[model samples]
Target chain A: MRTKNQKIRDFVLSAISVIVLIALWCAVSTSKPDFFPTPMATIERLVKLFEKPIMKVSIWGHIFASLKRVLFAIGASIIIGVGLGLIMGWNKKVRAAIYPIIMTLRPIPPIAWIPLIILLFGVGEFPKVLLVFIGSVFPILLNTISAVSMVDDMYLKVGKVYKANTWQTLHHIVFPASMPTILAGIKIAISSGWMVVVAAEMLASKSGLGFLITRGRDSYDVALIMVAMILIGIVGAALSIVFSFIERRLCGWMSS
Target chain B: MASKDIKVQVNHLTKKFGDLLVLDDISFNINKGEFVCIVGPTGCGKTTFLNLLTRLIEPTSGEILIDGKPADPHVHNISFVFQEPSAFPWLTAQQNIEYGLKIKKKSSEEIKSQVDKIIGLLGLEKFRNAYPHEMSVSMEQRVVIGRAFALNPDLLLMDEPYGQMDIKMRYYLEDEVIRLWKATGSTVLFITHNLEEAVYLAERVLILSNKPAKIKAEKKVDLPRPRSVSDDKFVEIRKDITDMIKWW
Candidate 1:
């Protein structure tokens, strides 16, 4: 429940967005009717979409498929990326040995792997998951490496003076101190994974929200395409919001 | 190990930064339970002298002895407080104060008791749970000093610990340092650019010359306890040190 002032503020902001969006739709629809849909028509089509079967092969199905692929990719990236990042950051010898390989591989786009991915993993979940992992892993690895390496030397000295062993120093000081930047990287990873998974699914998978959008485009159902697009936007926004909330709570001490 | 025993002895300590000789064959002995201040001009390498004593940086040549043996920073039991309070951002005041003891592997009971004593001693009970960001600059510095003192080190090395403070806060913290020094009876070697601060706190004031920094002058400040800046002899010693520093 919002207070009266809060309600007013929200309504005003929402109204401003609606007005701007309507003006944009009007301009685009008039200028290029074939490529654009009016605001009212899009809303009516969206309502028709919600009225369809809510159970099997519905929005829930697309949502679940997309979410499952995203989670798998994120999990894999965290495991491999954080492990490699820790090694590279903590050990100079390891950093020297592996950094060149990482730098060389990091430049290739995740989407550019579509042809290779289809050849290797076929038109299945594996390709989409792998693409998402590729999208998410580099930022997490780089951020973690930089964050851990940049911890103040004084703190390390203090730990040594107290006779803290190697494991103790890493666990108690290094990990906690570098967590803010790591969490920011995690937020970026999740959002990027979602985006990359959608593109990967459209190119490979037979099912999922991305498939729905591609199929709708083929069949000339603009309403279905618009609905899928809106779902993507909403999910992306929600994921970013959730990650930001977690980041704020986890790194709250820094603000104080 | 100190038991009404020897303090610090730096023997033939020659520290060079590449080709530049910072501390050239320097040697000094500090007695147990003494407050000694080193004063020098802006670029005289007073900071380098303290860093050698603290073993933050290894001396380019020669060695340091605490209680007539080689100094091990880990076991020699010296706590350093830098000019700026460097409380870890993530830890609250209570946690920061207890960090050294926790690192030394003290039992929880010991940590609690020591933290409680220092919090009360420094009048920091109100902000006990506050993080460094939440406290004023002076309060943050107070916590830094309190934390160092809680270690109960045999020797306390401070590098211009109150240099970043306002005049009023500086005096108040100086008095606190004096009070803590008297209470613990730990040997303290303080470095400062402020001539008045050096004269105010130390039994002996050692002044260093410009780069290739060596001891240019030394004065024994024989003032009584609870000395005031307004006192005639105190002002006189401060002026003499000021003049010596100007000469450099």
Candidate 2:
């Protein structure tokens, strides 16, 4: 719907916003250079961080270590959450049985489970992944449940009038109908998963952005800590942008 | 009485919501290929009656037979156009039209041919790939109508399908339904509270009394196709149905 000129104008406006943000950061850090670390110093440290291996892994290595865990945890949670949510929402008896369990565990923060998780699963990749899963799965599952409930009774009646079997109704009517809401939940899960993964990595492990921040704290390298912070934000934003693109494509009927 | 020519039989049909009686001992017969309108006053359980016929809900008593057997959605090729916009929003116009066939496990070739015929019939070629949000309100309803008729159903139940449309759009859609009806020769039971709409479309008008509603009258419409509201006979039949409704 937009003309080429309008698109260019919008892009320029957003670019201006990012430049303003960096300029503000530079001004704020000039007063307390040692404590805050200047933007240029952080950028220099980031480039150097890529050159040398901190804890025997490059910047890419640390990034990938965190990325792999978040990806695995979120992917597994989405599958498990959607399946459970669909069944619980569709069948009243199942919902009644599972309702208390979700309510009981959902309030407890993901970080609080570290001790029990470590004891049960041991200190390894699985525990970190499990922590992220605990943090993200509730949002995904709750959203999916709401999504199932959101499907209009009128649409289901139409399916019934056509004599669609239970499987057909679930496949054609329920799943597609609920996708917009489910996608909303996944967005929340991704953000929450990042928060949990970083905390888990900081507490234990020798690699990842969180571990880098821990090492910076020990060595008092403000620039190194700032670099890790910037990377976490950039990657989190990039992941969000990617999923936002997917949501536009998947639920075009709603947004369009 | 049950007969080969009759496509639908309602036998002592009754419905209740807890202690409240909604429909009391109603019975009717619709001949094959008939376009029958069940007209009633507002809040007179018109929808509940249609729902019972479609078996969306069980009757407190009585049974409805389609082709000499108890009505079953699986056994009968049935379709519906309800007051609500019933087209699946996720599907494009063409996919929505082909939905019933897909569920019935009709081959892809058969589904395509059937959907193509409906697309042409409803003049939706321009919007075959368009989603519901991209269409005008009337256009969306047309897709719903097209979807229902694409089934080439044995019985089509319409519950005030044009209730939300403006007068102009309603007339346009009514004619389209008639055209589809004639082309397919499927039996239709259309429910509406509007006497003019009933007379405009039905071959026979079945009047319902106000709540604890029962069928009070059935008048043959006998007027020719594409009947106008300005015509004397058309007005007379509408008045006759109106008078029956008023007397109750």
Candidate 3:
């Protein structure tokens, strides 16, 4: 009962805060052109963005462009991370060779490699995707490795007692056992990837939400910039919600 | 050849971790369908002895022969229930019980019948589809026990499986284990530090010494089925065993 009441109370407070912020904006601004755009102006600008083309692409096109890069990079990183991390965690020979290289590269920030990335790959979708991949891959890879290595000894004993062969143990025991931690890593990777794509776009792209934000800045359209920022925040929130739903579905056994 | 009734022969078994001897030249024979308990002090390498039986780790310098030959996991159908919660968290009660049958490549029909029987026997019908995290600890352990018994193993080794539970749960699970053991008639090597637990479950109890564990004493529990703790013989035997061991 308390939790239910708390949830309702929190929702109400959040709505109130947003209303107050909007009211403050309207109160502070005049009908004439001003430094800060009111909520009404921001809404009008957002509606206009959907109605007409900006920078030769519709609003949906720009959103899709950003979404595509983040999704593609995150997807590729999950595949690579699972593959390499499992190999590293299981096979000693590959682990010895590949483990140190990853450890060395892991501490280096993905954004720091932007200059080199742009120099090597050129300012294109590939560079932005690569940046997001670098930003996201570590959490997934490291968590997968930890998950595999850290499987409880008791479970392995159970496997041995049940006469599970090497492959059977890996398939039935290790993989499913690694899932909860891997999902947690995926959650981290996704948010990190989303943040990286915007920065990557701001640095390189000619189109995207980040590019749209930069365009707003270049044109000195405060309402346009506000629209882009609001869109980024909303999309970020939506991505988080979607990922949480996926996590609950995949690791239902862990739900409590 | 040894008699057909003998399931396992541990001849002069010993294990060493570096120079320190853990188990010192212990030998025993478990009959084909006997329930035997190995009782020892805490940290007395009882689990180590169980490990040797399972062949999870190699003995430093001895052999454990089953069926008058080498005991290898691949050749024998062995199952275990550890003290810790070893139920696969990803699987439901029913699925966890079916795991071994699937690994042994039993037919779908065999798997279904065996799983259904065990679930019914354990009274887990209501929670058969529940995952490990959803059930109480005792219920989860029951699921683990069911998983082990589903295989109907030639040898079932349980290492202090009820040691972590409360007294009520411990007694309840022990009764459940005994019921399963009686039903399956499987050879069980149960290890425990609890004297009452050993007395309650085992047909015969083998008590081990402190470190470099050796069979210090062996007592046949002649009490009736579902023996009461307050019964004269049960209490006497429990007291006798307690007096024999220098647990600390």
Which DockQ-derived CAPRI band holds candidate 3? medium
> What TM-score does model 1 achieve against the real structure?
0.87
RMSD of each: 3.7, 2.2, 2.7
**Pick by lDDT: 1 or 2, better one:** 2
Question: What lDDT tens digits, residue by residue, belong to model 1 across residues B28-87?
Answer: 778888898988778777777777777768999889898877888767788888777777
| TM per prediction | 0.87, 0.95, 0.91
- Docking tier of model 1: it is acceptable
* Candidate scoring better on DockQ of 1 and 2: 2
* lDDT at position A80, candidate 2: 92
lDDT of each: 0.83, 0.91, 0.89
lDDT of 1 at B39: 83
lDDT of 3 by residue, A1-256 (tens): 4698899999999999999988887887655445778888999999999998787899889889999999999999999998788878777798888888999998888889999998998997788999999999999999999998998887877888888988899889988999989889999999899888888888777778898888888899888888888888899889999999998998899856
Candidate 2 collision pairs: none
**Candidate 3 at residue B1, lDDT?**
31
Q: lDDT tens digits, residues A1-256, model 1?
A: 6899999999999999989987987887777655666666778777776567322466777788898998899899988888788778888899999999999888998989889988987887788899999999998898889988998887776666455678778877888888888887888899889989789877766667888778778778776777788889998898889888888888778873
Q: List-wise, what DockQ does each model earn?
A: 0.39, 0.72, 0.76
Name the best candidate (by lDDT): 2
> Could you say which candidate leads in TM-score?
2
Q: Candidate 2 lDDT, tens digit per residue, B1-248?
A: 34899999999999999989999999999999999998888899988887887788999999999999999987999898988788889999999999998999999988999899889889999899899988887898899988888888999999888999999999999999999999888999999888899999999989889899999989999999889998999989888777777765
Ranking by lDDT: 2, 3, 1
Higher-scoring candidate on TM-score, 2 or 3: 2
List ranges where model 2 is wrong by over 4 Å.
Answer: A1-24
